[model samples]
Target chain A: MKNQELPSLNYVFLLKQTTLEQPFISIKMMIVQQILFVIISIVAFYLFAKKASEIRRNILLGRDEDLTDQSEKRWKNMVLLAFGQKKMFKKPIPAILHLFVYVGFVLINIEVLEILIDGVFGTHRALEAPLGSFYHFLIGFFEILAVLTLIAVISFLVRRNILKVKRLSMAELDGFPKRDANTILYIEVVLMSMLLIMNASEGAIMLQEGTGNGFLISTMLAPAIVGLSPESLHLIERICWWGHILGIYAFLNYLPYSKHFHILLAFPNAYYQRLTPQAEMRNMKDIQNEVLYMMQPELAPPPPADGSQPATSAFGAKDVKDLSWKNLMDAYACTECGRCTDACPANTTGKKLSPRKIMMATRDRLEEVGTNINQNKTFVEDGKTLLHDYISVEELRACTTCQACVEACPVSISPLDIIAQLRRNLVMEESNAPQEWNLMFSNIETNMAPWKFSPDERDAWIHS
Target chain B: MLEVKSMAEFMASGESPDVLFWVGCAGSFDQRAQKITKAFVQILNKVGVSFAILGKEEMCTGDPARRAGNEFLFQMMAYNNIQVLNGYNVKKIITTCPHCFNVIKNEYPALGGNYEVIHHTVFLQQLINDGKLVLKDGGAFKGTKITYHDSCYLGRGNGVYEAPREVLQALDVELVEMKSCRSKGLCCGAGGAQMFKEEEAGTTRVNFKRTDEAIETGANIIASNCPFCTTMLVDGVKNREKEEAIKVMDIAEMVALSLKDQ
Candidate 1:
């Protein structure tokens, strides 16, 4: 009987030793996992930066422009457009919901700091002791925001997929854009769920320790999983915690490849927006130089030799490289919200003109150019231009230069400028203007009016 | 009515005028728009302001040419007009057309043609404010329902909304507003040189869409400030077979009808 009791006592001792050693083994494992994720996060950042700078270099391949005027006004515009979202309020319902997601997205990122600290040092709830009671409040606040983000993202998904908003379902948004939007929504939903699961599991462990503070969401969720043993709760918590951080790192890298790149580009895009009056059209300097040479030769420089000008140096944009850097940046900065197209008179009137398409085509052509450079270390002369290859002449001519697109843009992007530049190419370089336009041009050249009548006969109506 | 003098006539007589009337191409050519020209001239005569017309020497302001993307022609016409105006040492200028107003006031300064350019609506508003042009009590348009169509040039292009509205107010008419007005105004479908070119295939005509908004106001008269807008609105009214019911008139024509002399 004494020998049997001794064996059972030894068994109890063995169980206690294993239970005590569990944390030590996990600490070692967590350190290894932490190093792995850090390496992965670094690699993801490197790739994202590489892709982002490639885009920047490609945009700079375009002609140099001076959008640097009115710095004070530009800053104010950025504040109003990007931060204040002044134009989003035009549709109040979506604006309010989007505000929730936007705010949640920014605020929730703060937790990533605590996560990195805990992951790196193998500390459990490292901030809780330092933060005291505030940690519970912080977690509760994050939980609330997580729930809101989930709701907002789901609603957005429904709007795009279920409600089938016409703006989202347009022909241009059919392929990658449609999938890209859904991917971002799904990512948000997953991330938000992981956060809740992590908190809930943590709450279960705290309850077993008899120290659960009963934070709102986690406390509510804890009761359902409270029956689970401590070991299972710890495993669940560890899995969710790792998944949430990994998902965030992946999302950071995915932005440069997505239309959601606007999340990072919108501020700078608004900061560099054209500061001139809405009705004003930019005067082409090359045309202005030629006009000065013709009208006031004394103020103009001597004309260059016929062959001195490069064959590639056309009057206006024939390709992405002929556009201003700001124009390319505008394309990269498009939120794919379709507000410009919705407000466009040409589009509204059933014309084959959509400002949204113009931006997307610009981005697509830029990507093509970028790929060409990546393969050849320079442009390979693809025999395709943004002009006839991507955007047609019919679409260019259909624009009224009404500036509705510019006005309607929540980010202050001006698709009209792109239209005007392309139109300039057609008129000045290609001489490909519509027949009526050519007739009117000649009429003005000879008669100083868009009519066949002589200038002297202009006053005929007064006599009649 | 006072006879209007030409800049050539003013130059020959060595008589300087207070203002130069830049009667634009449509005002000088379109028969309907010509009446607006004459009406505005009569107001100048009634106000006894020393105004002169460029007449035969006046070239187009090159608004339509520039808008049509013909920079060469625009510069040629602009330079010619600028040369003539500067040669006369002209200072203050007013025009009945918003196209002329926009180009001369905004585009001309860039091409070395700087002058005090004013739209006829703003000028007429000033004249009324100065007590130079008096409105008659119970005039032709008095108590009549009028909806002012915001021309792209005068309203959106130049941000001159109050002047036209104020002019309508002086006529003692019931000034009703369309749903889209002021900076949010719809185009008359004649801007950007569309007046001279056929419109591209579209779901609906912008002018007719705008006219429908005006018609929705239940106003019998559609007041306009620009010749292009007047033409488009007139065509819009005719298309809806509301021509007999709705009279499309320039603000100048409306003011002329409400003048003490008329």
Candidate 2:
């Protein structure tokens, strides 16, 4: 068998011959496999699209913000921050490991495309004839990446569970978050193993046919399976192929419900990132108008002839719907990596405010609102809000607005924006500020300073 | 005493100064911060750069009110200040407070107030770069171990980290850096209206944490740019009872002391 010319196409034909004794039966089996693959792919994509549109709808429920300016700058930000993973390099060790997994995930999807084509058309190694040796090189590179991905996934799992990284194990990640992170890691591990095993099994049979010399990493494992009966080897190969494809579909649907959604959303989040200086909190234009109207009564809009007062907009965000759409998108784009929490001055100093938790709670509440909208075809008041129900006054007050968390975020999600809005609602809408803050506000209003000093004495420093 | 002119005084004389020195509330009233104002003014005067203060016309930039969530008061104050500033045709302004610098430069524009706002450290750095202000070799700060504190508003807030450090570099001092400086620099616990109210309960104060990092560098002087950070670090030093040995001086004060005699 080793002495045969053994063209790559002949290898697939032989694979079919060994799997089914009769040609007619093998052709029938191929049709059945094709139909099964098509049905599964349709269902997986349908479910994914359904959840993804629902998420889109939920994000759009937020107040509109115009982040469309500077298209070139936004595109550059997306390329550098999202595609390049520039911020991740702040911690070099995990960054390198994560890069291996990230690059592997992207590159291996090309192999997935090949698998899809094969499953749909009932043809094996379809790209081999056209590209020839480059195809062999591609698979070999993918095989090496698969092994690296496996190592990275396992290291991540150990870091999360055994090593117990402080950020990963924080109380905010207690139940579903913890499980979601580990589950994603475990899924990657299984998926990469399936790919490796499938390649190895296929390489083993190809070696017998004298056509498998270039599957770099898989060729090593191919020998252990070389002694298996041809029937068993073909069955193993088919099962791994189906498992790898199905597992990918499962992962796709799971993304809408997991922190792993950042993989898809990070690009758009980076593009829509606030492009102002970090400490520049957005001005309240409505409040400015109100002050203007007060200063110049002629600027105020006249009352209706029916004597109804004009509807005033609410001061700041009290719930998810009040937040800007970008804020909601920021929530969904969070990777749950806890880098924000780790860098939070409030959280690091034993305060209740974790910027990561702010993003997470915003996401959770937004999801709940989305579910409510899904059930009633419109959001009904749930008698709870993000301000008081999800985030506490203590947590909101603890923020220094230091921009540490904002700077620390790898994906450019600003938890500070949401925090500022919520804090605005707390103070402006509810007048719920600390006694000292209230005193400070009053002094500023009356004395034109935070302290109880006379405006007459503002220049006293000059004479002194 | 230096005869500091006000914008009103400059206007009455039918002349506008080159810049308006925005003596913030802290610089005007806070006793300790007044020294920073005087030092900055002395630098401007020594450089023969004509500048006037808003003096009694200057109001709070409403930074504390806005950060503490009182946008109404902040806007009201902003409106009045913009009126005064615009009335004066103030094209360029300089200040020693980062909070004021951040608000007036970044936040005031939307309310119809725009100016070329420069933080005093950045202004001093410009003066040094332009050769208008020369530092004496082996000045008072020479041979001293000085660690520059990157104030939240001035450093990460506005990306003005290098100017203050550059000003420090010109002092012939050994400028040691804290463990986290520049973009990763820790807050002095005085931002976001934290100065006006008590900090939320925590294991330790943020300023103490920041001050400890500065102390860990074994620097005797913790040089800072923002007045709020100066007060916070001063208190942090006092809490550690290291006030006798350690000093928190503003960059302006350092520059004032290190200026070459005419």
Candidate 3:
């Protein structure tokens, strides 16, 4: 048993006829494993990650009202968000799990190089032999991590299942959405099981051959393959190699497009996370003051002249564009682990706000925006059509601003801020706040409190 | 030299307490919290620290209204509270409610209520550092593997996480980390006026979710800084009839327990 090696999404080359590359004639390895894997890998990795990327870009930038200008600060923010994951640690466990998965996924490059050179390029020892010592160590390490990740994810299932931590489970407490959570957990468990099983099955080969303390345990399996006919050994090697590669590929591709895409986005989001606190996200100074800022009704730089305004220039964000660059980055960083929902008092108490959903909405919207952008649509024009087109007014109002969502996010994405900004737009700019917000504003202005307690009643506590 | 102001007058004064103990409505009206405030005041007085109370001059810090979705009222209260803190020329302040602590330290600056606000636990830790009080140190309380609940305001809200535990250890209580402690500390549902309003329709209460963690410790007591936490944890104990005879108290109360005199 060596250290755990992570699943790397590299184009592995299955080369023919290295001194070590013996052809296998095993029918099971050739016919059954390889074909199903190709399809699964294709669907999971390429289709999902690409589709998710497209959808999120469009949702955030599809409109003429869009603001995905790729500024230096935004790029810096992306580095911070996509890399630092500052927001993710706000929640503890899920952050840790997601963090490992992310590192494991990124380091997949090591293996990808191996597969491309060895599997595809016809260099049997091309990849692994070169990084042999390092490779052996790395695979051993990721294998352990994969095992640990599987354990952690399993605990999440138990919490969602037996302990029944609310908001963590998507069920109506009816045991259905929970069933879905379990199913997802099962998928993860099965995938990892397949991955590790292939490694261990191969490891018997390596162990008999006798390699020690490296990541790629499969190297040891090379000797175990010695017992089998050359053809059989070759077939098993190919089967296991494809199993590992295709599993990783499917996971990567599935990541961006599916709920699980948080797997891919979580790390970068965490790494490039905001340096300031969630409570102070609005305090990050604004940069762009082009009249373009004013042209749009929402991001309008301060009003002109006497300030005897027909309508006041709004403070805070109006849409994803109106949000600070980091804020937009936060939307993209969500891992959808439901940590925020689990911590949310509102969600636990049966309120409409699901922090996970908020992230999903943002990602979905970003996708909408991305599609429009790829088509060369102006955010200003397309944004108008895309917004009320995708998201609803009711969805934005459900937030309590408890900062639970803010606090629970492992990557530290503030779905709450997004929700608040949405509320700000509806209230300040559009004059269409929920009745409570409208009353709240007036109440603060006149009575200085929301109780609507009469000014006389203010002193009900004292005889003064 | 405590300047007392009603919620009404406090709204207008625009003063700041040197260390504004931003008392919420419960601190003023709830007997248990009022006692905590008085003890808090007495502790400062014994330490020969100059201080002022928002006194009768203070009003609800708008936490209740704000948490209840009455943002309008919350702002007014916050503005009024900020005005009083400013009037006093106060910079460093403190509070017992995680809610009040959060509002002043984390949130107030956004609405013009800037000050160096700290939670009481952190402040108490400072006092200990300054040699303000002495613990009997009869040795750590044996057979009590106590776990402290990181009140949302003090822990998650402001990140003053280690101070309370230091105060606990100073009193010599064995501390065990809860399953949901520190960054992942479970909420007790006493924040944001959840103490006042209805518990937003759930299978269980937040306090119970958190308290169960404490109970699982097989510890007899749970310690915290905020009064709302005290109230909720006490309720949690009563409800579960936790076999360990677990009781909830403010960290100040814990220190008071170790004190020879008032």
* Top candidate, metric TM-score: 2
Mind sharing the TM-score for model 1? Answer: 0.91
Order the candidate numbers by TM-score, best to worst.
2, 1, 3
Model 3: lDDT equals 0.59
Better of 1 and 3 by TM-score: 1
Task: Please compute DockQ, using alpha carbons, for every candidate against the native two-chain complex.
Answer: 0.54, 0.86, 0.14
Residues B112-161 of candidate 3 have per-residue lDDT tens digits of: 66788777788888888878776565833544667898877667666767
TM-score of each: 0.91, 0.97, 0.65
Positional deviation of residue A73's Cα in model 1 after best superposition, in angstroms: 1.1
What is the C-alpha lDDT profile of model 2 across A50-128, one tens digit per residue?
A: 9999999999999899999999999999999999999999999899999999999999999988998999999997998
Candidate 2, CAPRI quality class derived from DockQ = high
Which candidate wins on DockQ? 2
Report how far off residue A280 is in candidate 1 (Å).
1.5
Span of ten consecutive residues with least summed lDDT in model 1 chain A: A303-312
Kindly report which residue stretches of model 1 are placed more than 4 angstroms away from their true locations once superposed: A1-19, A124-131, A296-312, B128-133, B170-175
**Model 3 residue A134 lDDT?**
70
